[model samples]
Target: MGHPTPAAVWIWMFPLLLLESRAGHLGAQETEMLEGQECRPHEQPWPTALFQGVQLVCGDVLIDDNGVPTAVHCKKLKYTVRLGDHSLQNKDGSEQETAVAQSLPHPCYNSSNKDHNRDLMLIPRDRASLGPQVKPIHLADHCPQVGQKGTISSWSCVTSPQENFPDTLNCTEVKIIPQKQSEDAYPGQVTDSMVCANESSGADPCQGDSRGSLVCGGVLQGITSWESDLYGRPERSGIYINICHYLDWTKKTMGSKG
Candidate 1:
């Protein structure tokens, strides 16, 4: 469940809609994961929720004690991270909030209106203490293969796209699609820095799914990259930045930071 359709976005979470209007760096339709199922109370804990003041901004994954990656467009937000958070409406007492120490978006990130090349950013774990409910995932050493199955986790508003957002974590299974196929969907915008995925059953969103992370075979494989609104369309595909492609930069950034 991801990527907000403009026609359907107004009916989703209010805070997300407001955030998109301001930056829209991930694109207008790239906000919320669509048609996702809620996780059990505190079932999965690696995903983190980012916020600007009180507004929900983006969903991120903790890759290490000192690194959590998200979209570069989210840079302007008053950065704060919520760990061990499963519910958005109700506090389950597992939630722990911490201010981000700093962020380093890719220096080569292209900010063109139509192209979102290298749209990844790294934020340190900061002062948040780690525990059972709060842990980091390992980064992918090898690139994800085509047709590989992966799970995407995000703070989605698909089920209750209205005044109230769902109170649990949302995630869905997606398969990595061929680069050529994704190329056809995105045209010249598809680059080596990016990868594509699709929810085979056509159950959920096809693009960027709003900064959601693509985890394959138990490791962080890709980060969602925003794209056109392909919701309800016959061709189903989602764009993601291949995390393995930027392994060097990620390590350097994390190692050089606090």
Candidate 2:
């Protein structure tokens, strides 16, 4: 697909903003990959599925001290995280499954709001088995500036909702968009706690991609919160929970929780 102009990007994102209620949950069955490429083994180990039985809702993994960081809204449902597995259907021996002993959503998380600021939660596992294929990622010390590039990885759908989720992991590169652009697209909803990124061609996170990791310079910069479109349109950008803005909260939360 051809790249979308900034004006087109904003125009397309506007209507999506109004669908925030249905857009927020970003259901697993309706998610798609939208122009992303398959990820190589071990290229992104920090992203794992937050699932209840066979159903995948979002992506998550160990961030610090066996704590798994994901979108706070996912806390509403119970999940067992599977790490080191690329294919959700077939798992290699490298995969390790663990039950969540407890969850701690950021104290400031407000589900009633649409911006989804502080959209993060930490799930602590009692006996997590870590190895090369399953390890913790470092949280970024600073938020990426506008125009910086990052890679987002997930195992969600590779096409429209009519298709099945990919058996292998998928990844795509995205550039940080200017805050003003995000503000214009999202209006007063955009906040300091959120960051925005897009591809000129409109590649972005879609449904079932929430809580996925956004990595820049080998650091975990953000977590997928929501996107502008449900069908994985190439003209829309995605919003992420800025890890840098929540560094203190993360540290304190992880330290306090068992």
Candidate 3:
């Protein structure tokens, strides 16, 4: 799952949010992530049934008083993403539905600002364990070369310009904009764990795209960080976690087989 878009007005659009909990604060707020009232652009539609088998869930997590991961909280909301098989959602030739079980944002991610650093997170469904149909997305250890093209997929609103919220999984290709490495952040606010892509202003992430995948060379690179401007602007910015630099950290944290 993704962090809450901090813009303010974006939160007001999602009125159905299950409020009453601490995480419910965002139910009445609106940010750049939710701008379009209705009518999305044609180019920004959800992917075909080719990815129909996979189920997408949206969840949120909270830190405990001791700063330890207390429990995995689940959400009633679910994104319409298909992986490889439609059977998961098929009920006697009909459709089945699933929701989010638990979502854990990176420990270093500061949702209060969401400028940069540790923008990626993990989402797992309690009812549907990581199985063949629903497998963990492969993490890459390298970044895409300059000018290289890649695909990003997610069930966020950015995918569909027509709808104010996500109705299905959307995927699109973007180029890796060449960026100069510097000890100092280039964008003035970017962090060491973040990288830039797609210099073209209109080719960036937009509203309803938080926590979606920034894929390149078959690698899940970044997540929808923030929009450069609100009100459904075309140009946007994303905050991606430096996956290659954090391989060791992930293995240790997730107990990978190596």
Best by TM-score: 2
Can you give the TM-score per candidate against the true fold? 0.79, 0.80, 0.50
What lDDT tens digits, residue by residue, belong to model 1 across residues 1-258?
998799676676777867877677655434433546776655556888888887777778888776788888777646688887877668867788888767788988877665678888998866457787888889999999988998878765452122234556778888888888877776788898888777754534333445367889999988777656655554557678889999999999988885
User: Looking at candidate 2, what is the lDDT of residue 242?
Assistant: 87
Give candidate 2 misplaced runs (Cα > 4 Å): 1-33, 113-115, 160-164, 230-235
Alpha-carbon runs more than 4 Å astray in model 3: 1-104, 111-115, 124-133, 158-166, 180-187, 199-203, 230-237, 256-258
lDDT of 3: 0.41
The global C-alpha lDDT for each of the candidates, from Candidate 1 onward, is 0.74, 0.76, 0.41
Ranking by lDDT: 2, 1, 3
Error of 2 at 99 (Å): 1.7
Q: In order, what is each prediction's RMSD in angstroms?
A: 13.0, 13.2, 16.7
Most lDDT-accurate candidate: 2
- Model 1 alpha-carbon drift over 4 Å, by segment: 1-35, 159-165, 205-211
lDDT of 2 by residue, 16-123 (tens): 886875676565424433668789977677777777877777886578546788887776456687788787787778887776668788887877865477878888
Predicted candidate 3 versus true structure: per-residue lDDT over 1-258, tens digit per residue: 876676655677455454444355555343323322222222222121212135333211111111111111211244432222222243332221333344455676666773555555543323223333333445567765667776555444542234333454444556665345322324565655655554233334453334245667655555445434423333244444456655555545544211
